[model samples]
Target: MESTEWHLTSFVNLAVLTFLFLCSQGQVNGDCPADGRTWVPFGQSCYYFVHGNEDRFKSYTIEKAKEMCKDYGLLTVRSAEENSFIVENSLQVWKGGNNNMWLGMYYNSDDDEFKWNDESHVTFKNWEEGDAEDPEMPLIDTCVILHAASGKWENVSCSEQPQHGVVCETPQIRLQRKNASPLLSALVVISVIMILGISAAVWFLQQRKGSGSTLFPSFEYHPPFRAPSADQTCLVEAEEIDETS
Candidate 1:
């Protein structure tokens, strides 16, 4: 019985220790942000290709496109790699006539320079040669387009040109809700394990008690049956002998 109790206690203790060890080594989920609709991650930012509706196959002007991207983020671009990322993804979308998409850049006649909608410096330009300048209509073509065939930028009149697609860019930060702390999760698991262990211990003790095999058996005092005294025995024998005679 003692050995059985010792084994059970050892098992429970080992379970508890194992639970604690695993809890201490618990890990949280990865920190990568969740991907959004049509959004792809490249480097430290996310890019989305806003596809046109099926029926109309519509496109947006530069101003309208910026307004569309307003809820999520600004129409933006920075690097050649970023531009390429957008172009490649946008190519996957079903294209209509020109297959051109609006870029966030425009010609600034006042400054005689090209600038992004965010007013960032244009370090990278993928413009096709002889594009962005028209001898016939010099300053009219202010907006830029990513030509579908060549994946190069072309200057076009924003209003005169029919609507096209737009690319939306935002930083690759966690889009999902923050996870609970690893320590807190571990503690919760540990608590569950402890509760189960305690419940098991209680069940085992109850089983032992039900089977009349408790840790401490109750003791009752009862004097042993006493033999007859020598004088009593002798008198009984004499009486028996006299009666027989």
Candidate 2:
């Protein structure tokens, strides 16, 4: 029973070490960047909502929003789920102004279709019913915006009035731990545990027996001269006398 407990403890230690290693690699912690923007993580992407609470945040045009976004593109709503996520983050908590916000999608007059600025294929959409569907059609400069009040999308000129605050989008980035290392350390730990287990077993067995007793008491060695049996004695004076007679 004690031996079983020792193995269980070893495995538990291994799992804890593995979890810590993964956390250090950002595989477990999910630590996002702190760029003074409110970033919400969903699926594999991260969305930034403009709440105007940060000193760096302000209202900007679509192009300017793209510029301020750094490596992140403008907000792109792909699915109703994603659209709802954006709405929950942006419109529900919007404090910027009455104007609408920009999306990564734009009307491409050449293809006569709306497409994402990031060039990801449009697999889903959450267009507001009725007039919101038409951006006056075939206009190359037409762009999409999130309607502030209704929490839906709207069509407008890329540089039109009612410009909005910047809501950037970027893949989540995690900080690398400078002191993190690999699994070789775990192997060393296992070696130490094994040595400890062997020592513990030896101690347990020694305690079960009395003091001055070896682990295998039957195999204890002693000098032949110290033996009490005549057969084991080194000197035999009676046998020597009989041989001379």
Candidate 3:
């Protein structure tokens, strides 16, 4: 019937709307960047793809670039994960000093090794040819980043300050109470309970005091809590004699 058809149509529409709402609430997996910006959840990084070299800002030194990111609770770029995130966003932002943007990894001259500031191994690498060839490079040092235009990796001097594209080291969240141990958690719980208990006690006392009426009341004190000695002794003695008789 026509009525049955209308009811089914309404049910289908309701189901579709509910499905859409739930889909939007959860994160999308393997999805491209949303809007003009790509959200790199893995690195907690957001990259904005800019076409050509038009609107790029003046390059900053590694330290200065780091400060800028830090101002926004972000850090200078570093690491392959971050590099991939930037490329995915397709932005030509400056890294390092003048031309190179700062990446997360840096070269350790003392150890003569390419090490991630995050302590992760550089198992994967994508370097450009004729790259990692800084004349002043240390024998045992190598930082990694994408080529300015090609988004390829190259080794550069860690000490050399550049005014180009640079990556930031994402700030790591340190569980300050990491070593707090179970005793610390217990102490915190006990302290909270004590505070709540004290507050409750104060509230109870205030309520009790408010409910009791002592205002405008008169007080008469009697020693030993007995009435005046008018004839108490005589009455007691007479009563005793009568009892004996």
Best by TM-score: 2
Encode model 3's per-residue lDDT on 182-225: one tens digit a residue.
Answer: 67556655665565566556555555567685435678987676
Please report, as a residue range, the 10-residue window in candidate 3 with the lowest summed lDDT. Answer: 169-178
TM-score of each: 0.51, 0.58, 0.38
Ranking by TM-score: 2, 1, 3
Question: Per-residue alpha-carbon lDDT of model 2 for 1-245, expressed as tens digits?
Answer: 56556656766776686667546555433455686766889866787765554433357777777777767788877777877676666644564345467888876656767788866666776567863456465357677787655667767777555467667787766555454455665665566667667766765765656356766657658867754687645358677877899
Model 2 compared with the native: what TM-score? 0.58
- Please give, for residues 1-245, the per-residue lDDT of candidate 1 as tens digits: 66557657766776787667555554433232354466676777766667656633356777788887875554455677776666666656544344677777767777788887667668877778877566655564677778766778777776675677776767666444455687976787677677667766776776788688867788999999999999999999999999999
Candidate 3 local lDDT, residue 167: 37
Candidate 1 residue 96 Cα shift, in angstroms, is: 9.9
Which segments of candidate 2 are over 4 A away from where they belong? 1-29, 37-43, 50-59, 91-93, 96-99, 109-111, 130-135, 159-162, 178-245
Give the lDDT of residue 221 in candidate 3.
88
Which candidate ranks first by lDDT, i.e. highest? 1
**Alpha carbon lDDT at 116, candidate 3:** 61
